[model samples]
Target: MTLAAALAAGAAQTQTQAQAQALAKLNVVAFAGASNLAIWAGQQQGIFARHGLEVALELTPNSRAMASDLYSGKYDLALTSVDNIVAYNEGQGEARLPGPSDFTAFFGVDDGMLSVMAAADVPDLAALRGKVVSVDAMTTGFAFVLREVLGQAGIADQVEWVAVGGGAQRLAALLEGKQAATLLNTPLDLAAEARGFRRLARGRDAVGAYQGIVAAARRGTLAAKRDQLIGFTRGFRESLVWLDANRAEAAGILTARANMPPPVAARAATALLDPERGIFRDLRIDEAGLRTVLRLRSKYAQPQKELTDIARYIDPSIRAATFG
Candidate 1:
């Protein structure tokens, strides 16, 4: 081979390696379901790659563990309930960490399409009386939302509560009859309905306006990785847009990631695409929703305190910059 040819080939190889190395690496912990379809769609569509980010997504088994891991720098970011952020920031978290948390929600994900599901035999909230209901924790996460829901139904004092880990575990417990009822999100709710479970109430219908999930990270990480975080925000936004436009492909991705059948996956996709209450059309934090979160938390959170300022736990600059 000619020397010129060899030099050209080497140069091309070097350029390719440089481009690959330039992609920013980010570790994210999130719940597993159709609500997180944007993450899966981002990966499947190479949106993250296009924006120069290499994201590693892990499904959280428990909110407390995820919070601890996030605080310890085990993961760079977490896609979890805004309530989790509020709980930890206020020192009311179920799992205590050594130091004060520096976490802040910089992006809005969804309204936590949560549903109250019961065994086939249990027809409604009234029937759940005297039976055990599972939750991630008795004090934090969606447990409070469930409480408010029950209170609205006037059955709050009727049922027993148990901590059964995350959504997947709760679903399994409910299916096996270990628990008479539990809260489920996304495709799981659809799946539960398919398996003969009855949907007693929907979160939005029961609890009213609520902030579901957000992308949170240490304030220090946000400052240090501003460029990469922006890239992620952009990529995530693009993924949501893609999912809106490409339902079939998004459903296929959901089916593969969540291990759901094609029909169930399609229904999940439709639920997520709901313009009114599924994924946020624009990733802007809802003030009313955050207030609703605080109201619910104050009623149930340990060491409960009045939490009116939503800005205390949210940093909207990143989202504003990315979306604006």
Candidate 2:
């Protein structure tokens, strides 16, 4: 190569390295589901990179691990149920943390399209009576939602409740006939139904407006990595908007990243982008939905006092700064 040409190439490489180094990195963990389409799309389309952020996404086995990892600083942020943030913050979580839990949700994702998927032979809720049911934890995630469904079915006292970990694990047990049913979200629920499991009820239908997953981090992390958090939150919001506008691209993403069949992936993408029941377009926490979460926790949580304070689990300043 010529001397001037080689020098120009070297300078360009140095500039690229500098730009990459300037971008903040965030380690994020979330439950495995199609709800993570935004994250996957963001990474694929370079939305986060364009926002001066580098993201590493990992799928957690269960909420307990997500909680413990966050507490120990293994991850910078989490996409989890707002219920989990409330549970850990209120000392009602399944896994006890090392110190006082200050987990907080900073952004809303979706109303957890939680559905109770029962065995094929189990025709209805009545068939679930005297049968085994699974949950991520007895105290976190959507356990209370499942409880409410059974109670409404008049079989709350009859079914055996088991802590079976995350959606993937719970789905496994259900498929193997080890558990009769469990609350599943997104493509997992869709996959279950496709496999002959019956979706007995949806959480929203059983209760009312419900808050599902939210972007969260510990208070210390929030304060420490404020810039990265803002970038991530902004990137996620942009990703959602992009996915809504680009259906074909989103279907491809779901099929490839989520390991879904083409048709199921397309359907999952449609479900996530639905105007009413899909992801929250504005990415703002729904007050009524949060109230539903609080109400359910208030009724089912152990040693529970009435929990009505929505602000206790959310940090809104970041969203304000990012969007404003």
Candidate 3:
């Protein structure tokens, strides 16, 4: 068998052994998309098992619900856009949580593989006038991205913004003609293209390097589950390494677990594996990307404050331990 397949089999065996030992349960919440391929591969390939963790992964319909759940002690960690953490922590989020925001990002994933996807018939960006666009929340997620993209295209004020939830739901709205366009990431963006959607603008092309998804947890959770978080970080890093080396296997995992067709999964795997724009192999936060994220939020966030302190949202101890 190939090395990846061998690793897969070995991981399966390790998971079996770990189950008998009653591994620690970790509840992880994330948006639904191909960005999660590594996490899924980690679960199936036994990376987490080798780390002595039993991870339960769930897809949130919206960032509001994900934030609410994460803050309420319902989930142990969240793989989400760093923007959500910033929005909530700054009191700019659409959803109000139970307590003060202590969201901390410990692992970096990718530059938001974000693109403004318009229906095929919509033609150019200028053609979107008077059309309805969708967003996860008007205040958080990639809503700022949508605004900046359309604003530069000179039609920002011509469109209506509807609060759609996650990527799957936004893609559904686009497909069903409920909304004319929205921002989408890999796989879903590929899927939207398959359905005749036009990529009017790419976030990276319009804006620049952007920190997208990251593994986040509350301060209390980080303090209490230090060991478990360490194991998770190690497993997550291993998963990224495996994914980088095993493209075909990673695509297969996306198809089987994320339920994308073979072609879409293959394209997504390729897009996600791109060295410059894909998932971060080193798993280190791109300070440049973080700055871009902060800059956009500072400009667009309501009752806005200048957010320049990167130290406030990041706790790199777990990642430092795993990589060191």
Q: Compare the candidates by lDDT and give the number of the best one.
A: 2
Off-target runs (Cα >4 Å) in candidate 3 are 1-21
Per-residue lDDT of 1-324 in model 1, one digit per residue for the tens? 599999999999999889879988999998765547898889878899998988889998999889999999889999989999999999999887999988999988787889999999998898888999889998775898898888887878888989989899999888898999999988789989989999999998877778888999999999988888999999998998999899999889877888888998899899988887678868877788899999988888879798899989999888888977
Candidate 2 lDDT over residue span 1-324, tens digit each: 599999999999999999889888899999977558999999999999999998999999999999999899999999899999999888888787888899999989889988999999889899998899999988875999999989998999999989889998998889899999999998789878878899988988999899999999999999999988988988988998899899999999988987778888888888889988888877888889999999999999987779999989899988998899
Pairs with backbone N, CA or C atoms under 3 Å apart (clashes), candidate 2: none
Candidate 1: lDDT of 188? 85
Q: Using lDDT as the measure, what is the rank order of every candidate, best first?
A: 2, 3, 1
**What is the lDDT of every predicted structure here?**
0.87, 0.89, 0.89
lDDT string, candidate 3, 138-183, tens digits: 8875898889988898988899989989999999999999999999
Q: Note the clash tally of each candidate.
A: 0, 0, 0
TM-score winner between candidates 2 and 3: 2
Q: For each candidate, what TM-score against the reference?
A: 0.94, 0.94, 0.93
Task: Give candidate 2 misplaced runs (Cα > 4 Å).
Answer: 1-16
